[model samples]
Target: MTFLRDLLGIPGASSDPAALAAAARDRSGADPDGLPLAVVRAEDIDGVRETLRLAHAHHVPVVPRGAGTGLAGGALAGTGAVVLDVSAMDRIVEIDPVDELAVVEPGVLTATLDAAAAEHGLRYAPDPASAAISTIGGNIATNAGGMRCVKYGVTREAVLGLDVVLADGTLVSTGRRTVKGVSGLDLTALFVGSEGTLGVIVGASLRLRALPERTLTAAAGYDDVASAARACGDLARARRDPAMLELLDGLTLDVIDRAQGTDHGRRSRALVIAQADGPAADAEIAAIAEVLGKEASWVEQGVDAASSDALLAARRLALPSIERFGKALIEDICVPRSRLADAFAAVEEIAAEHRVAIYSFAHAGDGNLHPIIGYSGEARPAGVQRAADAIFRLALDLGGTVTGEHGVGLLKRDWLAREVGPDVLGLHASVKAALDPRGILNPGKAL
Candidate 1:
């Protein structure tokens, strides 16, 4: 324990319940009780290595944390262990415009990288909802997807390489900058969505794409949630590659409108915001508008750069806006594209059956739905748990995943086996045993 103090001073190891409570929860706001004994802030790669070694020796569970904006509670600290806060490691190691790549430390914010790339007329495309605050390490660990995932893919696609420190303080680089390489078994990809189970990411070399020359955004407001699902399905079927396609139901709109004090409550709207970049954007927008018109009340087109950007920003604010109503148990589930409508229908039915308020929104193009349930008053632990289980089970019943972009942190740990059967869960356990045999790296998560 003294060695631990040598690396991370014990003078103020942060045993304060208030500080620990804040570190206990994530954006999901689900059962934030298991607070860690100490919060260890690492300022450099050596510091992270030293901290991991001490934790390994002392058999202390280490939960790697980024910006603490994780919606899945993946960064939640474990009891009587250490919380590894990497936010202090913020740094941009390198930016090679000619190579279309940027090497950044784990703590660098996603939006910060995007802005740096913008200076060179290049952009990082994996823009998650919390890009402004979420760190690149969190994005890489979660393999987070965003509205543009319909066209650009998720964070895993943008990351070319990672500099990881293993459980026992062994440092290694997975993947490379070369455009193509098959020398290894793609260990880097393994670590991308591993949720910090295999190692602690110190830095990453990410791929960047040229910024779009022109952009057009259009919003199609549907009268109901099902119709909105139909519009999303149609676009996917027609092979329309809109950069961003999101849906917000009436309840979601009402919450956002009331929260933001806007006039967007005239209809039961399932709004779809799409972006068409490049020279072919005009024609693409036309086809998209025609398809959306089939199911929406109206397709409002905004070609002006400012107007389109503003609408996209507003759409991103949906979840945060919805949080104003009550405490949220945000459920992230993804079904197949064709099953999007069925998923929405099932979600609506479940909310009605349980008599709970659910506001839905999603990257509909990819079939990733977020059914955020509002719970106020006294925290009925059992009731809240039941509603979340029902929503996740519905997604699994429809041949969908229990989680889309969000990882199986503390919140969805119970439902993990439901989505991935016992056998697969066992396989995951075996891998976990091999990588972190002592189970010191973020134990009781994703297992």
Candidate 2:
């Protein structure tokens, strides 16, 4: 592998041991046994093409990485591989307001593209929590869903087309600039969630929507997790479509209050935040307030726009706030909307049984719960694993998936077969085999 980098002559490629080690892990927090031989920060399409071509020739494994913000260890370099870093390819090729599309390079941050689109009275709807730091390429790789997903959609929904570099350095483009096209197999969608195991995404053409003219938000406090969840179910049944609806358990609220030194301390066991966007915001929020009022202990009807933004900002800070209290392991599981209440109940039982401090929050509108266990106690890993296993099993039993948005990277690989069954898993393997016969493109990830 020493001569691999030299033979490629790829610009900005590095063999620094520290860089190699850094490239080995992502936000997944799991350290690999070994690191890649080199890290190549590709500046453009040519750089990516050459890097992959040389690695393909040598049969050296290639791991494509963006901002390394993935919660799954999809980008972790376990064996002797070459890490192709594309963060330097940050560029916005075009933003066509008439066509409602934004052409961008792989490294452009999600928030950056949104900001650029904002100038044209347009917005990219997939607002992941890590929007400020996570690159578009990474979001596409994971098919990431976020707060707005309940109303808008996920990364794959926003993606209209993609320019991908295959394992053998073959550049193939899929999808089209037009919104409605059924030309062939949706290869663009296929690559969107493949987590780089199929091909490396070099460019993306994203569909955009006009920015909402008005926004309204509502909040409610529940006496128990079940009540809060029922309120979410009520909102789901209502005709109104809110841009985002979130939940924060009492403990998570306490952590946020402690971290920020605020006066949010209340007796409610859970807090529900809901928002609606567009010209009919007032009516939609009025409807949401009605549903929540039925089950909430106390309700704040139609908070001011500024207050709404503040409430959302606070919701976004849930993970970091809890991390300040203790060692936190965040689990992402989404159950059926009706089973959300049961799911929370199970997590509570598991936490009490295992004697672990578990705090939770969710995109309750979508039945996605992030149960964060904060523990700084004895044998933390064992306790965390047990609690996680219980929570995930409960989700699966409720007819939910192991991952809602996060890909089946190393962290969730163990349970994927069980969720999808052997036949479905075999199909995934077949697809992987057809696209990546060498198994060099992000080996040991996704499928």
What are the models' TM-scores?
A: 0.95, 0.97
Off by over 4 Å in 2: 1-8, 377-380
- lDDT agreement with native, every candidate: 0.82, 0.87
Per-residue lDDT of 164-217 in model 1, one digit per residue for the tens?
988888889989886577896898898998888889999999999888888898
Q: List clashing residue pairs in candidate 2.
A: none
Candidate 2 vs. true structure, TM-score: 0.97
Clashing pairs for model 1 are: none
Say which candidate scores most in TM-score.
2
* Highest-lDDT candidate: 2
Clashes of each: 0, 0
Q: Kindly report the root-mean-square deviation of model 1 from the true structure over all alpha carbons.
A: 2.0
Compute the lDDT of residue 413 as modeled in candidate 1. Answer: 83
